[model samples]
Target: MQSPAHGRRLDAVTGPFTPRTPRVVAARRLHRRRDRDTAGRFLAEGPQAVREALDRTDTVVELFGTPTALDRHADLAARAARADLPVSEITDEALAALTETVAPQGLVAVCRHLDVPLRTALARGPRLVAVLAGIRDPGNAGTVLRTADAAGAGVVVFAGDTVDPYNGKCVRASAGSLFHVDVVRAADPGAAVAGLRAAGLTILATTGYGDSDLDDLVDHGRLAAPTAWLFGAEAHGLPEELTAVADARVRVPLHGRAESLNLAAAAAVCLYASARALR
Candidate 1:
């Protein structure tokens, strides 16, 4: 098992890679987690993701595009060239292979993995952190990440059985916030929580039947300090064992007669509340 601190790249080694063909047979293999993990890379498709990935220095590995896509978004190729990154002109069939979208965006970029060790994120003295423990849905996880980034959370932890941070759906769902925030993929969520606590972050778990109310926490200024918010699986919510470790279990109040909000909605409410209070 890799420790949290092992997550550092020391220096971002921009690989001197050339996309021999726009098809990038190399990128096609990255659809699987094992392939992505082994290569230390993942795929980001669409103009938005490709654009954002390229905006960050040393993040994009190689870029692939159909002529139509390149022509439609000409600036992307220029950006890639300026960065001295490989740009491959591929066929529609190749774009089909590289992307999972029903309507392929005709653009794909190979990106270096963004996850760092929990220790690295903690060392930064992050005021807001979002922990996705036992979350298996990539879309939900990605949405939460987007929300976290919007709410000023500097770090996001994908712990235990959580979805891969590099999952294609997750990358698109993050809408480029994946590159904006520090990420931690912890095998042991308990250790992740312990490290956060050790770093002086108060852990608050979100559950439907929690003892504390979301508005009340903000009202009391309880969220003004460094804090880690733990969110659980979509179907089962947080486990008893995990929930027991929380300083508090918080629920969003339902004033509109809505039974509940989905994972993403609830997260947005909680994270924003904390964001507002911390300000």
Candidate 2:
């Protein structure tokens, strides 16, 4: 085991930092999520992702790594050094203790979370946006955000019962696009939809059994002004209330007998198609 001297906690010691008292562990978990809402703090892990976040945002608070990990990510270390970022060197075991994953990648970052207002994201006049309602899977949510970013959507809204965007898996899957796009967490679904409507954004719900096929209903060449594609959970689909408020319900044309597409896949197709239509 390797350890180093640091300002706060001892460098990674032999074991898992004495199990970090149950209360402390619980508090850190809460911090991961609440930090975003309350203090504008978020956690980014893994060398590549942390490096990306550090390069893009000025919100990084602390950078944690082991000697081997730092060697592998010399560029990031150099940047951190130049910025005077608080760096903590610990043993591999200690790094694992602070990480959410079973196999820690030996790097984790505490960064200031972005809380862009919905209106601010819409300011540039985005014609396509993705509104995720009640998406419970972190992987699914991350994929949706990634797709939205790729499709050039202005923002992604997580409305009601959705998985935390800061979840380690989601952050990893997003491939640092999470730093590039606007991600907003809504207090309620109805309010979010209402806000979009007020912004002159048309809400389109994606359903497996909609009467209008996405191919036919959406004229790629003549997309309507400011559109928001609404996707529901994979298992339950969108709630009836949400679907009811949509300006239109669209379904992807499927030639096969497959019941439905995965939520993330469906979101990507919808966002891409919508973006293509606008262009």
Q: Tell me, by lDDT, which candidate is best.
A: 1
Error of 1 at 60 (Å): 1.0
Worst ten in a row by lDDT for model 2: 1-10
Model 1 C-alpha lDDT per residue in residues 1-279, reported as the tens digit of each score:
111221111112322123444237778889999999999999999999998888788889878777677778878877786676767666676778788999988889999997888888888989999999888999999999999999999999999989999999999899999989998999999989999999999999999999999989988989999899999976889878878999999999999888788999899999999898889
Instruction: Assess the local accuracy of residue 201 in candidate 2 as a C-alpha lDDT between 0 and 100.
Output: 87
lDDT of each: 0.85, 0.75
lDDT of 1: 0.85
Which regions of candidate 2 are displaced past 4 Å? 1-40, 219-224
Candidate 2 pairs with clashing backbones: 12-91, 40-113, 220-277
* Per-prediction backbone clash count: 0, 3
Weakest 10 consecutive residues of candidate 1 by summed lDDT: 2-11
lDDT of 2 by residue, 155-175 (tens): 888888888777777887788
